[model samples]
Target: MSQAADRLALGRIGESVRREDATPKVTGEFAYGSDLSAPGMLWGRTLRSPHAHARIVAVDVAAAVALPGVHAVLLHGDVPGAKAYGLEFPDQPVLAGDRVRYYGEPVAIVAADGPERARRAVAAIRVEYELLEPVVDPARATEQPPLHPDRPTMRHGYREDPRPNVIRHLVIRHGDPDVVGDVSVTGVYELAGQDQAFLGPESGLAVPDGEGGVDVYVATQWLHVDRAQVAPCLGLEPEQVRIHLAGVGGAFGGREDLSMQIHAAMLALYTGRPVRMVYDREESFVGHVHRHPARLEYEHRATREGKLVCVRARIVLDGGAYASSSTAVIANSTAFAVGPYRVDNALLDGTVVYTNNPPSGAMRGFGAPQVCFAAEAQMDRLAAALGIDPVELRLLNALAPGDRLPTGQLLTGSLPTAEVIRRAAALPVPAPEPLPRDPLRLPGGAGNTTHGDGIRRGVGFAVGFKNICFSEGFDDSCAARVVLRADGRAEIHCAAADVGQGSASVILQVARTELGTDDVVLAPATTASVGSAGSTSASRMTWMAAGAVRDACREALAERERTGGADVDVEHVFRHPQTLPLDPETGQVTGARAHVALAVAAMRVVVEVDVDLGLARVVWVGVAQDVGKAINPRSVEGQIEGGIAQGLGHALMEELVVRDGRILNASFTDYLIPTALDMPPVTIDLVEEPEPDAPYGVKGVGEPPTVVSTAAVTSALRDATGLLLARVPVRPEDVALGSR
Candidate 1:
């Protein structure tokens, strides 16, 4: 085939090739980590502290060790090497040491021949706890005793304050500090902690490699990071710990932190046999970190004509017992506190405080969703005061390519904020469904509690933007190797985790597109073979993986041309354009290179409120997103749909109920998620303006949809009820009763 013909053949980049795992996933034939098994494998179970805050008087594992089927029982004292491991900070104890700071803290592990035996051994272990007052309130967490008295300085030296509970305090002061507008709206908003609630519970299989090494098969976001953190704890070198990606059912940032990785390895090594650990539904809730429940006090000042003048915000996130990624979360919250609107003057202070609540870390939308709720609500309020349409109000102040952020970083990527908002707002609204609305269509759905009395409809609009990759000077890079096979197929190998995000497919697409070949093979993701692709979080997998694959394929193609069709292999570590660290005190970025790229999304939500019942039903959601480029339009749309679903869940029903630092509802029966019946129809408008700096001009597509959808849904609820709904997971009580 001629080069010109090959170029015209649409190899794969834009085509929505069927996801390789879709059939097996749908048919229940795909093997996840939980499905893994091995001969003579021991089952591991953890003994958790019942008390939220307590001094560990004693941990007697004697009885557990003596159990009939128990192969080994371990305590903090039994750890052969490092006793603590964390995502960003090595502050959390692998096994509770002298005290337990939060409920469900792992205290002991039991390895036995069977799960039942493991459970029995775990029950046999005795622990005596002296209950202590739990520091449940994030507002006062800093005033309480330090969760980590010897907490070390953060990796980048961002926190040198020596404060006990405050992980990081980032302040953004841009333009005039004290600028009050003629019209202003001030409100305090609260967001409940949300669970990633991924379908596959945290599970993994760890096998002793017989030579003082461990091989782990697990579902995780970043295998290399897991190995880096797990290796030292296991008293082994980094190369001694190998991780292979087990099929992940779903990981919306839930699998970023270490769960059973080290524990499974320790058990396997101790028992001299392979070991498997799986968290049940209830344990899964406590085993992993949650979305930081936030309290945001926001004051938006605008000109009488609905132009944004300034935004002042204080965002406090409940770090919850450990600093998984709280520092980064706080930075994101502070950076995007003002949402997508352009404001000349802004003052923002964001803090993540350590509390004895469930550990809070990464979730879909990261920290942006919480602030987006507050900022967008403020936009609506400001519009009401100015007597202007909300959409028009956002358009008047929508950020463009040259607008500066509160953090002093200038927007240089494909923002297209105004275009997104305009396109979403222009989409035709669907007519309300006919009356005698299926009892299934009512707020209570099949419950039939509502007779459609006092039903009112409302519409709300919101727009939000988030930095694409790791920011604030984190060295982020991905490595990929492309092999041009003699069989006329291109093979791509990268440690980038698929994580059910179609990243593997995206890699294949990029390889086929760059090499102009219809066939491409994806090597399994493993840390033992390839270099680090960094964490799959931050919606950076597609961008990083595709860029690396494209670059490596380009190099391999050149070699193949030189060798005249002989097999060629090339590896490339694709680095994103450099980003500088922010000024710690001022939270300001000086250079134009603070973020790899940026993506914006606009959403319009339609909701109906049953005023008497206080139940709300989302009618439809229309969204326009600046994806930069659609490498695979189907996958991009799927991402938007999935993100919107999670966002809708957060806006209406998803909350991890915590009381006095203990999760009250950990079971799925109690913790509600959206069902298919609850999902509203979504209409999406694709804004494919290419990002000049991104791979194939593609930007991160997974997170922006979620960033704005939550705000839009809740805004609609506020509009329908005519009430200032200042919190999320908006309860029926907030909108029900004698109509607001």
Candidate 2:
């Protein structure tokens, strides 16, 4: 193909293709996971431990088994094969056998004819527990008893000490670690645990095939991985367990980990009947993992002219109970610890430790957002110390193409860091309305807590970047099958889970663009139909899935041409360029690359603070992202807006409060997320700087908006209040109490 064709925009790639599931989703006709039901399906309920740390002394299921409506009562002994499962390591037990390490660890399960009956049976199942002191602090994890022993048998080749609770401790030393600059600023930032708070609760339906196998319909991020993990626990082969994707409400990384997938299948297989499990709002909070709460200490060194010299950071992540993708999270945090800036010398250490807190796993932005907050804060401090404009300072140090990351990976792809920052900073700020207007304009809004008595406005800026695909030698690939039908239409088959990131629409758009036909059909994502399309995560779906679809379509078209316009079917697996694992001692990746590509975002946030009432409201968010390409402009804008809203919630209100490792606010009434009123108006600048290797020059756009929005908002708050705010979900008390 010539360069002219590569530059041409045709079919649906750049057009705003209407979402296939939009109408059904908005009209309430879509059958989400919670809406799935089977005829004669029994309800499944799990009995969770009440104590965060306790010994399971005895379990008597006689009462539950005797219940008239109950079909099955299962305990630890009931697990037929594997007793543990996880994405990275099999550490979390299918059912707690001896001791429960977390407050909501599943101890037993009950299947009954109805939901209420299952709940009653769960209550009736007698279980005796001896309470133990909980290790709830990540800072003190090394002094606590070993959560998962650090022996050779348990270690999965990742570097770690024989400490009590440390899961992975990654150290990176690049350039001159001992380099000192003319000026230095140090700060410590703390981030709270945040929930995905997806609207749909975890739900699933499982039915026995009456042939020693089962069919499961569940809302999850990866169907093949679920099948692999569930089949082992059920004592069945992967083929025996067919997994289908139910309609997902939203994932945002919450559904990346297993939830009710196995429980529903276990009950269905044991009872010889269909089983359904739907977690209520309260149960959903404890059922899935939350974002890891992070504590980061950063020191930024720069010359008097505000030129960055060196950066050193120590990041600690609380990996509650089990190691679910903790190693990957730590790697990302360490790699992007210094933000999207050029640092000559750096020293970094990132660690994730086991504790009795609620389990923390994948969340939007992965682990980069936590460190971004700290790094951006340090940048602002440095700018203040150097007496320079924050935006100018960031622009001066912005990473560019050919720049080397702290991981030692050469930026061979597009690195528009300075461009993104410049565009964001140049966005026009919204003008203020007349005073004595609506009380809703105040921070307290209709509550009338403040009538514009002491409101002040400030603007702030931040930039963040992260690896676009799974890093560290993960075998990431996507399989696609394209069939050019006799009617000149194309059908695409792939098991890429659409967790509300518009992967389905993106796949169809890619097919239409490649096949040069508007009549493209996207098949439902299922493991029984296609090979693994990998997880819809790491912002790799668009690149991997679309690449596979394009490859398969090209083969199908070529075959059709060879056969004189006959129908042709082709299957292909799109593999990313190999990424190497980081060297343990030096923290540098030695191979060609550690990440496929990097996606950068810059944000300028406007915030209004009411010092008297200690309430703050984000006014506007101006975000500039280098997306390489926009498959659909509307969807890209929606993703950016949604991400900014979520990020704003993280900055101001969303916090999963825990006391002694127990979640205090599990329901929405207690936990706060950004409502429509809380979200600021987002203005997005889509910068098309295509990666030469990506399909259609597409880079990930989902996680970057979220990565820096929080920092920008926090920086604004600091500007308005003149206080060094070091913690997230900045409460009104923090603002009001520390008011100057």
lDDT top scorer:
2
TM per candidate comes to 0.97, 0.97
Cα lDDT tens digits for candidate 2, 1-740 = 00010111224788775665678789998788888777788999999998899999999999888988999998888999899898778888999999999988999999999999999999998989998889999999889887666432235556656678887889989899889999999998999999999999999889899998999999999899999999999999999998889889898999988998888888899999999899999889998998999999999999998889999999999999998888899889999999988887999999899999999999999999999999999999999999999999998899998888898888899879999998998999998755787777778877878777789898889999988879999999999999888889777889999888888878887888789887777777788778999988888999999899989988888899999988888899999889889887789987979999999999999899999789998888999999999998888888899889888999999999999999999999999888888887888999999998899899988899889988999999999999999999899999999995
Cα lDDT tens digits for candidate 1, 1-740: 00010111233888876776787888998888998888898999999988789999987778888879899888898887898888988889999999998989999998999999999999988898898888899888878888777764354658356667888888889999698888989999999999999999999999998999999999999999999999989889999999988879799999999999999999999888999999999999999999999999999888888888888999999998888999889989998899887888999999898888999999988899999989999889988998999989999998898888777777787888888988999988899887876888877888898878778999988999888989878899999988888879776779988888788778877887788777777777888768999999898888889889988988998898899999998889998889987888777886766677778999999998888788889989999999888988888999999999999999999988899888999998999988889888899899999988888888888999889888999999888888888888998887775364
| Runs in model 1 lying further than 4 Å from the true structure | 1-11, 153-155, 563-565, 737-740
Report how far off residue 229 is in candidate 2 (Å).
Answer: 0.6
Model 1 Cα shift for residue 489 (angstroms): 3.3
